[model samples]
Each structure stands twice: as C-alpha cells, then as structure tokens.
Target: MPSAPGTGKGGGPDHGYPPVGRLLPVGGGVVHALTTGSGPDVVLLHGASGNLRDFTFDLVGRLARDFRVTAFDRPGLGHSDPLHADGESPAEQAAVLDAAAGMLGLGRAVIVGHSFGGSVAMAWALEHPERVAAVVTLAGATMPWPGDLGPWYRIASTTFGAATVVPLVSGWLPDSYARNSVASIFAPQQPPDGYLEHVGIPLTLRRAAVLRSNVRQVAGLKPHVAAMARRYPGLSIPVEIVHGTADTIVPAAVHAHPMSRLLPNARLTKLPGIGHMPHHVAPDATLAAIRSAAVRAGLN
Candidate 1:
C-alpha cells in the first residue's frame, strides 16, 4: 500500500495564504503532507509516535509566514500508508523524503525535524547535502538505544510489532495510557488538553508500519550518529539543536549533549524546566531557535 493524502481539515486560509493540503505518491505508498505560505522551503518532520500535527498549531502557522512550511505524515501514520516491506529504514525514508521534495519543486530546504524526525532529516542531509539548506533538531535522539528497558516498554515494543492486534486489545489499555505516556515525556507540568487524544491515539492506531521501522532505526542509532558525526565537520551549512534539560524520553546527556559536542558548527539551546516535547511545551522558544537558525543560514 502506498502512502496516501491527509483526510482531515488543515488550518484555514489566512491573509490570502492558500490552505495547504496534498498527497504525493512516492514509491509504493503516498506521502500525505501540506505546504503553506511561500518563500524559502522549510520541511517539518515529526517524532516517534507522532504525525506532522504534533507541532504546536501556533508555531506551524507562525513559521508559514516566513518560509513555505511543509509537514507530512510519515509512512503508516495519519493519512499516509505504512511501509509495505521491511526495507523502510531511516535511510530509505530519507530517500522518499528527497523524492518528495523534488516532486514538490523544492530544490533546497531547511529541514526542521522533531525527535525521530530529526534523525530522518539528519540522515537525509547526510545523503543529499545539496538539497539541504540548513538543519534543526528538536529533542532529537542521536545516540545508541538504551540497554535497560522496563518490562512495560519491552512488552509495548513487542506488542507494537503486532499492532494489528491493537484495535482488538485497545480496550485493555487504560484511557489514561496515552495521556500519561506523553505527560511523562515532559516535566511535572501538564501539557495542553487533547494533546494525547489528538496526537497519540491516532498515531498508535494509524502508524504501525512506521512504528516497526522505528524499532530497527532506534537499534541502529549509535552507528548512524557516529557516522554522521564524522561528516558534520565537512558540513558548512548551519545546524541548530534545541533540547529540554528535563527531557526524559531522549536524555539530553546521552543524545543532545554528545551531538552538540561533535558537530563543529552546531549551536545548542537547552530550555529550563522543559522536557522531550519542547515544541509543544515551549513553542515560542522553539520558534525562536528556528528563527535564529534560519538567520544563520541566511534564509531570513
């Protein structure tokens, strides 16, 4: 099954900026995505267990003002179909993204990737340097998978492999399961209402293929980060990393800290009292970091 277009309503048109919606077919599946506003291109990638909409709504709208904001549902998430085979690794996903960019007439784009999306964007930039104008990673995981996993996580991963069974067993999962899961990623502060309902449930239900591919990608992170780190010194483009000091999902010490140290020209921003999903918890700060990176890239 190829990726498909998004079926839900996107943001309404504002100030004559046409509402953006599209489903571009690439390879076996179609990639559901949207493009809004106009100028230099900026591609937004969502993290694990999330779709493009995971970005704070206001942030997306704000970014669309300066750059042609492009966001998409990865394979098997939202309206996009999952990978048809086991070959849909991070590198392969990057290839699809490159093809999508070409199809969209974006020759070069500033890639703003969140969490796992950051990994994808980095891999894409590494593979096709010419197509990337700059790179920004938000709470990205750029390290090896953790050796220790609680029993629940192990079980969840195993069950996610058999996600076809999720609908059948969703009843057994507590109502607060998804909400609590996302809440744990942040500090003690509660996230916006409907956060999990809007972002989490649909993802778990719609993104089985991507979830499976992520298992493999997570396992391969160490080598990938190491290889990419070696290439960073060769990169002249601007790279910015934003992470939360209190992030529990992808620890700052293990992921962002090492990444910031390795990349020769990288700038790192650590948000106080923030957590994994900084884009949601601190949209203003995230947007500021993005604007700063864009300025550094001479796109602003």
Candidate 2:
C-alpha cells in the first residue's frame, strides 16, 4: 500500500538544495532514493550528470498528485554510493535500481527515464519485465550512434581523467559555464525560468558526478546499446518515447524514430523545433506521453 506523500530531506546545508533522498542500507552499500505521493507506482531515473533532484525539481511533484513518485540518484551521481568506482553500464544500473525498488515494495511501476536514464529504464524493462508496468523514454539514446561522443567525453572517460582531470575540472568549473551548458540542452526552446537553479546543475560538476558521467558516456556504449536493441522486439510491455525533433544531443530522427519501428508496442511523440531537454522544455507533452504509456499498460 502506498503511504501519504512525505519528504526525506528538504534543504539546509547548501542554501535550499538537498540531494540525498532516503538512504537505504541494503546488504552492504547505501541506496539514496526520494519517494512521495501515493498511487500507481512510478519510478524516475534521471539522465547523465544528474541526480533525483532533476525530477524533484518539477515533474515528480506534478506526477505525484496521481502516482506514487520515486526518484533515485543513480549510483555515485548524487548521494547514492557507487556500486563500482569505475562506472556502471545501463544494465548494471537497472539491476541495482530494480532490486532497490523491490525492497521499497514498488512492485511493478511505470518506469520513466529522461535522457541517460531512459537507457537504464529500457534495460530494466528488457531484463526484468515483471517489475516494470510500463516505460516512458524522453529523448533516450537507445539506438547506437555512429561516432564517438566528442572530445570532452573521450578524455574524461579514461581512468587517469576520472581520478585526476575530472576533479581538477569540477573544482575550477564556473557556474556560468554550467548555465550555458544547460541553455544549449534547451536549444530551439528556452529553458523555463529557474529550471537550472531548481535542478542544481552545478552539482553535476562535483567530482563523483563528473567522473561517473564521463566514464559511463564514453565507455564504448554503442556495443551495449546495439545488443539491447536486438532484444527490443522481444519486449512486449507498453513503451512511449518522447523526443524533440531539434535535439542535437540525441536526435529523434536517429534514436526515437528508428526505435519506434523496432519496438512492437511503442509510440513516438516528436515535438518540432524542440531541443534535448524535452521534459523541461515540453513538460506537458512529456506528461501526456507518460499518461498514454500508463493507459496502455493498464495502470490507469
């Protein structure tokens, strides 16, 4: 049974931003999670270089009104302890998060993934179908891209960079640079006022966030995704993919368009002239996609 919505951590130290959610000490390590509202279970996994705050900032609060919202900091991203010091593949992330959800009594929820999180959500749906009621992917990088992720990720993914370079960069990184980066993600559509501050984008520059993000991004992810893509046809659960046509980071034409045809029960929602961060740039459309997935999954 879902309990009434409650807060695990609210704000105190860093002005008004609290990263750690509910810390669950399972077996050995601790898993940080944020849970609220009470209804059909919904688990949110954030993108790369982010934490649960990404959702808690806006979408979770709104979705909580209709669903029990649980957003987790992927290992080493926010307050969650790292399962591996190097990095975790989407499949590995899915395993850890799925087990954590099981411990929380989240028994089969509509899994929503934004950007990098969308990849993990797909992995969960593919590997553990019983625990996933449905799937909603927002600008997910599911299909394999042709080339490398560019200079930054290439250099940062190395062990030497993760240990040395990342910390150095994170320490000297400017907030303005971070803000500009956020703005780029919202290209073709401006980000909502205070969205960057609300999500605590600067936190992504932290040592752990930087290292884990880079390591995961440039760690030859194409092979893994290609393998995952092969298994999509076998996945029978409801899937809703929400993408912006103008997303330069992960183009809908490349990822979402091809994915829609691949999945037997998948629908694509392509927003014209929108950029990468559709959840923030186009929240209503994203919410509608989630609702549609829920209905298709028989959760509504």
Candidate 3:
C-alpha cells in the first residue's frame, strides 16, 4: 500500500492521513484497525464512505474510558483492501472482520455499528453468534426501505459508471462538494468542528475503489437487510438501537422501529429533532446506549 499525498481539494495517494494503528494481514489482504483502552472488548464498525477515524474522532475516546475498543476500517474503504471487485456484501464484510477480530484475540464483544456498519453488525451477530455478546446500532440501515435509492446509486453501480464516472468524480469533485455532502448527511444538526478533516473526506471520495465499493454495497443493501430481518427473532442477545427521528437518511420508522419489535431483547432510543449522525449530534444518548448494552451483556 502507498501513502496518500494530502487531504487537499484533489485526491491522490498519501492524502497525508497515515494509519493510526497497525495493518494486520487477514486472508489475502490486510485490515487496518486502531485498538485502544482496556476492559471488555468493543468492536466498532463505521458507516459507508468512512473509515475507523469516524470513531477515533470522538466516540472511541469516550468508550475507551471504560472498555477496550477496536475500530476497523471496513474492507474497500480507508486503508483496508476490498474483498472483491463485484462489491462485498455485509455478510462478507462481517466474515472478514470476524477473522480479523479473532486474529486480534477479541473474544465475545459488544459490536457497535453506524449506518452501513450497522448492517455489518447484524451480519456479524448472525454469522458469528458466539463471538458477539451484544449489538448496538446508530441509525443503522437494518431493514429494507420501500423505495429504490437515488439516481446516483443506480448509475454508479453499473459497469460504465464504475469505469468512467467513478474515477472522474473521485478525482475532479471539489473538496467543497464533498464537505457539503458530509454536511447534508448530518443535516438538522451540524457536523462537529474538525470532523471533515478527521474523517478523511479526500481519501473517501478520491479513491475509485472506495467509491465503487460504497456504491455497490449501498445499492444492494435492501435485499441483504430483507434477508437479515427474517433471522432477527432468532437472535436472543441484547440489542440497543439509537436513531434520530429527523434522520431521513435511515429513518427510524423504516429500520429501527421495526427492528426493535423483531428482536426479543432490544431497546430503542429515538432522539427527537436529530438527523442521521445521531452518534455525533447526541453523544450522550449514544454513550448511554452503549453502556446499557454492556451492562445487559454482562461485559461491564
């Protein structure tokens, strides 16, 4: 792997953001993980178009105060290699992360996932039940939504888009555009100071592989979640769900509400007037959810 040039307007290798953790070889490629603190194990999986830095920005430090935390850059994003070109499903991502967790000696842990990571968390618990003590989702897209995704998703997942539009958009799209996109995700609640810099926006958008993986994963998420939803009742482990009422990106009514009803031991926290990034906007609620999960899981 090469270094990113810098987190400037344009994207290139060595975007000046070096890995803050070790790159462990997993299977054919490597998985980048930043581990810290001490106590019961807590594995954090970030959303699409993001890396482990999202947790390291604020949430990880808070959680680390009481529990051992490992934040992974999901395959095909950040420094982690893509599992395959066709796009790795949430189950595939979960399997790879589980392997990486085993290599790191992580035993049964409270798996926390945000957005796309939430789906991966579900997959993780479903596929490797013995390793998961509990589960937590922050505005997770757990169930399939009614309608199709936007035009960008439809176009970007195609062969033409992957070869042409992906590279063009990754290289030419200005930093302002990307910043605005980030801001929109956290609408109704502004992004915290220095979040754009800390989250590695340039690396997220500039890399064609990252874009392709994200596009395909998101485009194909509905069917996967639909399948996962059927098995929710089989999961008896405690689950804590945190979602913002105002989060249009992954609406609570669509995912969290139904999920709570499905899971036998599930608690839902709905933050009024909050948007998609509930973990950042409402850290208190997010922290509370994690603590609740830990206590319930007997890990505290």
Candidate 4:
C-alpha cells in the first residue's frame, strides 16, 4: 500500500495528505482521531473494537470535497488515552464528542457513525439536538443489545473484561488477534491486508482500559437504546440510516428497521448483499448516503 504523502510513522501528515491519525486533548486524556478534508464539519465515529482509520482513505478524501471530516477513535481504541473518569457510557461518549467538536472550533455539524459509533451519535443528538446538523447511521446498533450474541461474543467480552485486570498483560494483545476478531464480524471475505496495522494496532492493544470500556459500552446498550428510541420523536434534525440486508453483526431486523420505524423524520437505505462493514466494501454507496443525509440536514 502506498503511504499517504507526508504521514510519518505515527500516521501523521507525511506526504501532504493532512494528518490521517493524531491525538487531541478533549477533557482529561488525549482523544485519538483522524481529521482530513475541508468544508462543513462532519464527525465520523467508528464502531466497537475499531479506531479512526477504519474509514477508508478514498472515502475520507472524497468526502473532504464537501465536508471537513473528523473520524475519532473512541476512548481507548487507538492513540487516544483511555477514559479514567466515570460515565464512559454511550451518552458520556457523545458528551466527549461534543466537547471535542467545540475544542476543534466546529459549529453545528453532521455526524456519521458506523456500528457502535452510531449508538454514540444517536445519544449525542438526543442530548444536544442543537449541535447536530444531521445524522447518518451505517448498520448502527439502534436496538437493545440482543440477548444472544453467540458464544464468541460472550467469551470475547469476558476475556476483554478480565484482560483489564492487569495493564501489562492487556497491552500484549496481538495485532493478529485484534484483526482476526474484527474480521469475524464481517463476511467471509477479509479486508485489505495491513489495514489494521496502518490504523495503529499496537496502540489499541496497549489500551486495556479502552477495551474494558467498550465491553461495558456494549453491555449497557439495552437501556440506552430504549431511552434514546423514545427521544427520537422529539428530534427535528434530519436522520438517515443505512444497513446491509445481509448484515450479520448487528442484524438488520433489530437496528435499521426498528430505528427507521421510530424516527419520524428518518430515512432508511437498504444495501442488498452487503455485510456490516459497508464503508470498507462499498465506499461509494456509503459516501452517497452521507451526502444525502447532509443535504437533508440543510448542509448543502
């Protein structure tokens, strides 16, 4: 893979590509995320077990034409330091995002969240409706956490939780392990090789607290979903939801379909034959959804 022009060892700007991965102090510790493009501010949040680099390089560059995109590594995922304070729930994560946006001088902007990030975006919009210009959720976990996530998810969650006991031990999580685990959530086909490596695999593995926080974030979804879904009726801002009909990770029946039904002003776009990671597999369609959502939100 060609290295982004000026991006250095740490994924910073190296070849005039603008910094693709960097850290910014949000509240207490630094928040790890990537910023590129220039236009209406659009915050992109990745899913569970993912960092900022999850957004495809081409997608970020294309979106930059109309929107300044900021894809953040939720607490503990990438270069950002783990959250040490209480209230690391989805709602709290949204608050952290709000603060980060302010610090970056971003006014009301659109939010595009994928998988777990979608949940955070919804919670953020519910809490601070005025700050959000619009929202686009891609295969987001809008419904309550399913009771059955198969044995693997349970084991992984438990393992991740236990790993948090010792920082040193947790830091030893292998890049292969992280990559394989993430790959399992998608279709049989794998993403491009070295994708995780380029996105800071070692940094994420070292952040045990962030992993633990993510496990808790996943577990606490039921109540958050219930409450947030109810608040959708009050949302005046435009909303868009895109989900692959064949998604296996979050399941379309629970999230995309239900969320569309609840949100009076929301539009749902179904992608046939695609899986959970549409942005990686179908960047153009994902970009279209984002642009459509932005237009609906009056960001044109």
Candidate 5:
C-alpha cells in the first residue's frame, strides 16, 4: 500500500487534484476510480503519463449519459499506487485494475483504452475474457513499432536515471517545457483549450515515481506488444480500433493497420488528419466505436 493523498510521501504526487470518485484497495495497493451514469459497464484506461482525468475531461461525461462508465487511474499513474519500483508490465497492470473493477462489483464491461492504455485493455481481455464484454482502442499503441522511443525513454528507464536523473528533472522541469511537450504530442493538431490544467500536467511532471514508471513502461512496451501480438489471432472478442491516419506516436501503418488484419473480429475506423489523442481530437468517432463494440458484443 502507499501513503494517503496529498501526503507526497510513499503515495503518488499531491497535485491537489483529489479523487473525483472512490479508491479501491486491491492487490495490496490502492487504485483510484471514477464511476458515473448507469447502464452496461464501461471501463476506461488512459495512456502513459495520464490519469483518469484524461477521460473525465470530456469523453467520460458524454459516455456516462448512456453507459455506466468507470474511468480508472492505472497503477502508478495517478492516485493509484505503483505495483512495484520497476515499471509494471501491461499484464501486471491489467491484473491489479481488474481486481479493482471486481471490487466495484462491475460485471462484464466494454473495456476502452487510449494510447498506452489500449495495450492494457488488450491485456485485460486476454487475461480475463470473462470480465470483458468487448474492447475499444482509441489511437491505441497495440502493435510493436520498428524503432526506439528516443533517448529520453531509454535513459529514464535506467537505474542511474531513475535514481538521479528523474528526481533532478522533476525538481527543476519548467511548466512551459511540459506544456510544449504536450503540444508536441498533439502536433499538427493543437490540444483543446484547458487540457493541460484539466489533465494535470504538474501531477505527471512533479511526481518522480510517475515519470520513472511511465518511462520504464514505455521503454519496455515494444517487446510486450510483440509478445502480445502473437496471441491476437486467438482473441475472438469484438474489438473496435479507432485510429488516426496522421498519428505519428503510434503510426497506424505500424500498429492499427496490421492489428486489424490479425484480429478475427475487429472493425477499424481510420480518422483522417487526426493525431494520437483521437479520443480528444474526435470524440464522436471514438464514442461511435465504443457503441459499435457494445452492439457487436451483444451489450447494446
């Protein structure tokens, strides 16, 4: 278990963004979950360096109008406790979050994941098919890419970086630089107004644990996805893959395109001129994909 909120101790960073819903103690660590609306279950997982707030910013509110939406802060990202000092594998993350969902008494759910969260969603469906009604990946990083993730990720995941560099960067990183980084992620298409404040960039930048965990997870993601991809053909559940043609982070050519072909039952929706944040860039399309997944899974 970790320390309480706002303590800034063994727990996550105290960014003053309190939990909007409840916290669940499962697998010996706490997970933060925001549940809303009422209907068939919908579990949302955000991408790397993001908390549940990513969905709560807009998508979850709209989805809540029709479905019972539960947006969770994946282990170590937000209010949730880190599974371990080393970056947690997607399967490890899925295991802890699934336990949290079970504690909430949620039945089979339409699992929706964004960016890195998409990998976690796939892992969840792979590990606990009985608990997942379907899956939706919004600009998800589902497949292994061909190149490295750059020097930042490479260094951040190292022992020396985690012990010294992470703390140093966290201590002195300027807000402007962080904002610029966010902008770069949404390049070609600017981020929506107030996304930075709403999503809590400080929470991610200021927390050494969060930064270290994120880098480790990202650094180790390619191999994980490669192994996971080998089993995609065996996954028979409905999968709605919503990707952007313009996504540079997880290029559609590298991931979504090949993944659509591999999955036995998958519908790919390619949004033209959209970026990595498809959920935010094109919420209507994202919502439609989720709804489609629900219908295909016999939930609607």
Candidate 6:
C-alpha cells in the first residue's frame, strides 16, 4: 500500500490512510481536508473518532449544491498528523484547523461542528472571531458534563493505555466491534445505509495516534469547556445550535440548551426524540439550522 502523508502515533508511515483527500501543510504537521461545492465556504469539523468522510457520506453532498463545503479530518484521526502530545484541548485542534482553512483559501465562512467538533468550532469562533461569519453546532458538547467517558475512554486516556492498550486494540480490534461502536453513537437512530464503508472505520480504529488523542480530549473535556464556555458571551456573531432530545451521548439538556442560554447571540433548536447523530438521523433539521445561520449572518 502507498504511504499516507502524515506520521502515525508510533512515528511510522500512516498506511491506515487511503490516498484520498489533500494533505494541507499547517502548523508543524499536515492536516487532511476535502473540499466540494461552489458558493460561500462552509467549514466542517467532525467529532472525535471521525474524519472528513463522515460529512462526505451524505451531508457534504447535500450542502455542496448551494455552498462550498470543506470537510477536515481532525488532527491525528484519519490522515491528519497528531498534535503535540500536550495538545489535546479543543483550542489546540481549533488552532490547527483554523490555520488550515486559511491556507486552503476558505474565508469568513460558516463554521459547522458536530459532537466534539462542536467544542473545537466554539474554540475556533472564539479564538478567531474575525474569520467566522457564523456558527452552527450540531449536538456539540460545549458545556461541562458529569462523570467520565466509561471504561474504554477512561482506559484510553491513561499513560498505561497509551503505551499498551492502544496498540493492542489498534492492531487487532475486530471489525464487528468497530461497526457496532459506530452504530451505537446513533442508538435509537440507525446509521442509515452504507455509513460504515464511507466512514473509513479501519482508519479510525487502527490509528493509535487518533485513539490516544480522542480519549485524552474526552478525558479533559470538562475542564476545557469550563475554560472556554465563559467565552461564549463574548461572541457577537450569529450562532445556531441543533441538538436532539434523545441523544444519550451528549444530551441536549446537558449541552445545547444551557449553552444556548449562555451565548449572547445564539439560538438553539431542539429535536425531540432524535438521537446523538442528528446530522445523519435528521439532516433536514441540521441543514435548516445552517441555512438559518447563514441568512442571519448574511453569508448567502
């Protein structure tokens, strides 16, 4: 197999990545990104354990008709290089992606983030308010939550896990478990058809760099939000947030509702009985939110 551009966690060729997407040079390492569409730019940030393909599966195609949709693989996941070992915060990822967007020639576009990507999107808008035309967070985790991310993440976040557990799973993790894990995120809402193949499950699973970075990001999310959440009120740009009531992963009540209350210029749309994967389960609703924000910010 051909070598992927970015270095893997163990300092080896990123064979896990296929020869798709562009390798964008930014910061100290390169980030992988894909662009589509023909109008105003819309920057897409995928959640943890995801790549640009998540949007490419459906959302990118839908939005490409009206907007320039650019999707990025979060650093260390998919084909992007891992940030510095200490760089686990949303702010860190946001910085890298922001630089990439500028390099890719995306200017003053609507920033859309889903799940953990929401956190990064919030950071991006906060840190670079001048660059963001508007913000759309889909079931994003912007508020602090109680408890840890269960056993898998708990273990993956540890020093021992990084050295031992991560490599074990990366090398031998079964396809069944990986498939089910992806499906579980959608829960009551099935992952539609052919999501797994389009999503590049093995790339996400087999990359130790991504595994360590994701779990560490999750482990440190609460405090990270605590530091960043206070900055929401400072944002004067239009912000649209959509979250599902049935989302067990990042409940609307736990994140979106309260966060909406905090933003000075933001509105939250509550999707009743919808699960965590709102972008997949409720694309129309998600699209509507993006359109609304674009209109409010006059990006159209």
lDDT of each: 0.68, 0.78, 0.88, 0.71, 0.88, 0.83
Give the runs in model 4 whose Cα sits over 4 Å from its true position.
1-22, 85-87, 148-176
Candidates 3 and 6, the one with greater lDDT: 3
- On TM-score, the leading prediction is 5
Off by over 4 Å in 3: 1-12
TM-score (C-alpha) between model 6 and the true structure: 0.94
Clashes of 4: 8
Residues 179-229, model 1: lDDT tens digits? 667677666567787666445354443334444444444444556666666
* Candidate 6 Cα outliers beyond 4 Å, as residue runs: 1-19
Candidate 6 lDDT trough over 10 residues, lowest sum: 1-10
- Kindly list the per-residue Cα lDDT of model 5 for residues 22-66, writing each as its tens digit: 877777778888899999999999999899999988998899899
Q: Using alpha carbons, what is the TM-score of model 2?
A: 0.91
Write the candidate numbers in order of decreasing TM-score.
5, 3, 6, 2, 4, 1
Tens digits of per-residue lDDT, candidate 3, 1-300, equal 322323211123746676788677776777888899999999999998888899999999999999999999898888887777777899999999999999889999999999999999999999999899999999999998998998999999999999999989988999889888999999988999999988888667877777888888899888999999999999999999999999999999999999999999999999999999988989999999988999999998
Task: Give per-model TM-scores.
Answer: 0.83, 0.91, 0.96, 0.83, 0.97, 0.94
What does each candidate score in C-alpha RMSD? Answer: 5.4, 4.3, 2.8, 5.6, 1.4, 2.3
Q: Best to worst by lDDT, what's the order?
A: 3, 5, 6, 2, 4, 1
Task: List clash counts for every candidate, in order.
Answer: 7, 0, 9, 8, 0, 0
